[model samples]
Target: MAEDFTPPISQMQSTTLTDDSIQFENFSRRVLIKNIVGRPDGGVGLAGKKVTVGGWVKTGREQGKGTFAFLEVNDGSCPANLQVLVDASVSPLGDLVPTGTCVLVEGELKKPPTGTKQNVELRVCKVLEVGPVDPVKYPLPKTKLTLEFLRDVVHLRPRTNTISAVARIRNALAYATHTFFQKNGFLYVQTPIITTSDCEGAGEMFQVTTLCTDAEKVERELKQNPPPTEAEIEAAKLLVKDKGGMVADLKSAKASKEELDASLSELKNAKENLSRLEERSKLKCGIPQKDGKIDYTQDFFARQAFLTVSGQLQVETFACALSSVYTFGPTFRAEHSHTSRHLAEFWMVEPEIAFANLEDDMNCAEAYVKFLCQWLLDNCLDDMEFMVKNFDKTAIDRLKLVSSSPFERISYTEAVKLLQNVTEKKFENNVEWGIDLASEHERYLTEVIFKKPVIVYNYPKKIKAFYMKVNDDEKTVAAMDVLVPKVGELIGGSQREERYDVIVKRIQEMELPLEPYEWYLDLRRYGTVKHSGFGLGFERMVLFATGIDNIRDVIPFPRYPGRADL
Candidate 1:
């Protein structure tokens, strides 16, 4: 008898919809985008209007005589959720409706029962079946779930409440960013992605290469199949000689191997050959020799290039020309950071202001953040509500805090002093006056010491960028980083070192080549002015705003190291 029995729930509801039956003209209320989500007050009260709402059905529940399906409908214009109740037995096309289908609810609007959670619920009149949805195969289950679980199903996350909310808030941040810059008279700029200059000065970068050459692929095949035996090494050397050089030109423009044998051949020979030959090879290849001088000719470009870690340097040049310029685009870092906060490729919003100093930069960052917060409150209430209910309940309160209070500012020296004296000691890099503050130290200062966001400034010159202006003491630079409670460091900035001689001397002292940054130094020689700017990790800011902890969650299609699944 148990084997013959079936679950009563399976027989309850069965209707589906698609693009065909969703008649736009028949929807009693041809709802405009703004009315449905943007402004509820302006919408003809859902109480008595004859309306039709169309969206992907979330779940359907049945209880004997009636059926209820919670419709998570969106026009993709906003994050507002419109719940439609379908008790279609007495209405048209109700008997066959199923969950997880495209739905068009032609109904009479009524306020949800006085005690229920939703403000308005559409009472279904005519249900249109336009497509089919299989419950078991559907991505979103009708059960309560968590964001962590949803992340594993990356494709389905966008349909979940937390992700839905994240999407809206992310959009709001983008809009706010543009609006803040535009209103402030800053020229919105788009920088190149495939740039020749590694703006961050950090060596970590994803090398862009074309398709693999037949010779390169063959070399790669030999390395993988037979392993590097003595014969394979000799064969590789022969191939290098035969191909004239590395497979760069031979490889197709669309494919690239990780390391071409030709490039590696030079290194292998240098290692195995005589001291004189090794020295000559190192010079010819421009390769770095241990305890030896830099070989210029061997350097690609007879120079160096890597993915930019920050746009501040490049954007600063524009600021010199435009007096006020901002760059909002992708920045990359090559650090082997296997952490949530660091991404190999992340978006940064950097603003450079001419004739401005540290104070001006702080004001701009604060004002920009505040404007974004206010914009989210006004524009993304639905997303905000969804996040509060599903992701983090404290997110709304945090945004409010940002809007109402001025962010605190402290010097790096003071931060060091505070950390050194703290009774509770768990710092991995023990707090010292001149040492760089690790992420743990930053969190302690921002989350515990201040109990609010704080900007720590004037870091020791040794740890900061070379362009930062040296302070009166000469040991510290006019650098600052804004730290939020959970998001450790949100922004890093400085008043640029503008004097030509000072910058040159600093470069020399830092042991970085004057030749590579010759163009950058020319700015000071020509018409350099007092200027300041900061680089804000755009994704991190979104994380702060939406209460999404993982940096990967904020970015759409994240490209972290060794992970490039679209």
Candidate 2:
């Protein structure tokens, strides 16, 4: 059942690629450093082959009495850096000896000296380009930097060993995600970034509107031409009175036609000036509103809109028609949380199945997750090594364990009983039947109790979303969460409630407006087939795979409450 993209990945599982069968060539004419250094032989076998390479220098030092320069260049194609030897005649040693210098050179791949860590070295024949660095102004040095410092200089952190590997791993995972779903006969669909409906029914959504910009526009205009003061308005009014008197005098004296026209023009001009000043003075800086409420009619969308918290609802629409569909896109939440687990904006992978139940949903989730773990092991061991050396030592082993082990399935009630029965360790949150499971509870089950991934299903309806299918007991919903070590709940899913009357009742019981969801109800009203779907926080997958601690580090740009810097 494997697809075309499967063989290369599968082949990579056993041995390192030494052939052109798996290439990471970029569109540029220059060859990727990965294609050279990532080989089992580390380009030593390709000696005497002339090639062009482009990258930023991680460290450069002049040697041989300034006759040549040795540069450790990394193009971020891989975690490894290629050792480049540039002659003073081919390129200025000074220009190439800086930490952040950009170097593009045509060189012959040669074997390095015996006993060196590197297997291959580049002998440059000619310098193609050079972007010199001001070493004094450069922020990153050869010294070791803390992760907190890296976060502050996120713009340049990619050049570091850690972040670049993270970037590559992230790229591979994203590619693997699309490949897995597409190979499984699922269509990739795009859901909206701006939505009118809150799929989670939680009001923690970032409101998207133009009202703030509109208010800024007014304030900007006033700043450029400040509003007329009360004294200025009075002066304008006095001018208007004087002009009226002059016009009246001209009419009474039967002045010449030219004088009468001139007087009338002056009167009109004065009146307009007075009116303008009065209006300007009355202008108060504030958001325009009506009836003491935000006039959303003046907004960009002509109504209240928000950055989508999840694409599940929209993807479900596609699943109804396409049978199998998935959406991977950015989702936002306005939760004012400052924990390592929360991000204001993050990505989500939501898949909806037209004819699947809770069991099928669990099967799909398990398969997809296992595939991701195996994918990393097969393709990203090089980058994972970097993660291990720097962040977490158990990163690779965890991946292997999850990829090979079958996730244990248990009922939510059973999991609660297990937590309540724990005698060795105490939980901060009390174990209860109706309460939603917290991260500590989840981690305890996966890490302490089972020591493997676990699926807890049949959550209490009151603690779950309204769209979850009600169970036979009428108290629980067909909801499931896949929890794992390091990270707690990695995926949340449920069998959707497809009955129109039941959904309407549920919506009413939750005190949500039915008008906004009329279209959703129509799906059931017309011809609803049983469906199920799940939402996987993309960052959580990256965190789990990389064993990175903070949710912010895995993503390229972390957006939290006070930090959205690029």
- Evaluated with lDDT, which candidate comes out highest? 2
In the range 1-566, model 1's lDDT, one tens digit per residue, is: 55664423313332232211111222233443335434434233446767666666555555455544445455445556666666536443232245556666677766666686666667778875444676668767778876557656777677665666677788789889989989998987676665555554445676543222433654565456543445545665565465544445545443345555555566556445434333333222123444586443334544344566677777777888988899998877767776878787889998889899999999998888888888988878777887787678988888887766788999988999999889877777888888878888988987788877788999998887789999999999999898876678888889999999888888878777777688888799998789999988889888888887788788766667776555
Runs in model 2 with CA error above 4 Å?
1-26, 222-284
Q: Over the stretch 1-566, how does candidate 2's per-residue lDDT look in tens digits?
A: 85545334323343355543334344455767887888887777777778888999999999999999899999988888999999999877998889999999998888888999997888999999999889999999989987778889889888888888888888888998999999999999999999999888988998998889878888898999999888888888898898889989988999999998998898899989888888877666776688999889989999899999999988888888989999999999999999999999999999999899999999999999999999999999999989998889999999999999999999999999999999999888888889999999999999999999999999999988889999989999999999999999999999999999899999998888998789898889887999999989999999998888888888898899988896
Q: Which residue pairs come into collision in candidate 2?
A: none
Pick out the ten consecutive residues of candidate 2 with the lowest summed lDDT. 6-15
Per-candidate Cα lDDT values, in order, are 0.70, 0.89
TM-score of 2: 0.87
438 Cα displacement, candidate 2 (Å): 1.6
**Over 4 Å off, model 1:** 1-34, 37-44, 62-80, 85-99, 105-107, 111-118, 123-131, 211-305
TM-scores of all predicted structures: 0.74, 0.87
How many residue-pair clashes does candidate 2 contain?
Answer: 0
TM-score of 1: 0.74
